[model samples]
Target: MQAQARGRKARRWIIFGTIAFGAVFLVVGLVLAGQSVSLLNDAERARGTVVGLEWRKDHSSSSRRNRSDDRPAAYPVVEFTPAEGTPTRFRSSTGANPPSYEVGERVEVLYHADSPEDAQINGFASLWLLPLVFGGLGLLTSGIATVVALVTRRRSRPRRSLRTTGP
Candidate 1:
């Protein structure tokens, strides 16, 4: 009986945790998606040139274990001229090894009308990837949790006995 009680308690905790985790992901996904839409609508389009690469050495937990981690990862540095303003320079949020773009490459960018320095490379991977991934994972986890809870509850219920009287 004690073991059964513990099992039930564990199940309840699991359900609660699953719900909380799912809710967090869903909320973050929604917020990120909204921001992406707002950026798309409000930002102005401009042509930018890759002026350089911003390199930084990794010293974080995962990188600490490897000896070769001392090498720097490079993020693109882009420069663009907004209308009614001088040329502004900004580094990209996304980075890759071997450098994603060359110093002379021209790329499409979106910048705020007021703050042109706040810019992003207009692309699906950079813009909408996070929101889609988080939203999808949240829906999947919530659905699985709901199904498990329902199935467990159904199996734990006592079956009724049918009584028949014959004349």
Candidate 2:
């Protein structure tokens, strides 16, 4: 009886822990989403060209390659003319394995009119990737917690016994 009670407590702790973890992720995702929206609202759009690619060694934990494979990711260097400033060149913070853009390719850029040096490529991956990834993780963990809670509840229910008498 004591062991059963301990198991139930452990399961409850697990459920609570998972829920807390998921909530943290959800909050982070929401904060990032809000920042992205604010940036877009304050930014001015301009036409830009991929001037070059800056290749850097892939040291991020998200990299999918084995330790032996050491391939560098390519981040685009863009040059654009802001509404009130001369042409400015800035490298994108996001990088891809196969290179997302080619040199001389035209693309949409978003930047503050006052600070053309701080700009970003106006695209789904550039702006929304982090929020989506974090939000997905939060939902996944929350779903797991729900499933565990349901299973624990079902298992805790008492079962009925059948008896037969023969003459």
Candidate 3:
């Protein structure tokens, strides 16, 4: 009985941990996804050119706590001229190791109708990366947790017995 109780407790803890993990990821994903949806709905499209690249040097020391020590990242600096406004220059928030964009390359951009400074490169990879990543992880974890709980429950259930009368 004690062993069974322990098993049940462990299984419960597992379920709880999995659920917590999934919920955190799901919430983050939903928030990001919601932001993307809002941007898609109200943002204006424009053609922008990669005018330059900004390099960011990592300042962290090479200690156990600092994993990114000396690695540097580069972000794209784009210039776009709105229909009724002067040409605006903005730097992308995302940075990549090898750099994602080249100077003079034209790309599609999405900017807020009222605030052109708030803009992002229009694409699945740039706009929806966090949403897809977190949502996928949340769904995967939740599915695994469900499967584990079901299997545990099945194993713990009392089996029915069949009896035959005297022949």
Give each model's whole-structure lDDT: 0.85, 0.89, 0.85
Q: Give candidate 3's TM-score.
A: 0.83
**TM-score of each prediction:** 0.83, 0.82, 0.83
Q: List the residue pairs that clash in candidate 1.
A: none
Candidate 3: residue pairs that collide: none
Which parts of model 1 are misplaced by more than 4 Å?
57-59, 62-64, 67-73, 162-165
Local lDDT at 82 for model 1: 92
lDDT of 2 by residue, 13-130 (tens): 9899998899889888888889789888988999999999999985667555566667898999999999876999999988888999999999999998878898999988889999
lDDT leader = 2
Per-residue alpha-carbon lDDT of candidate 1 for residues 23-98, written as tens digits (9 for 90 to 100): 7898889999999899999889999999999997656777574776456778889999999679999988877677
The ten-residue window of minimal lDDT in model 3 covers 61-70
Residue pairs with backbone overlap in model 2: none
The 10-residue segment of model 1 with minimum total lDDT is 62-71
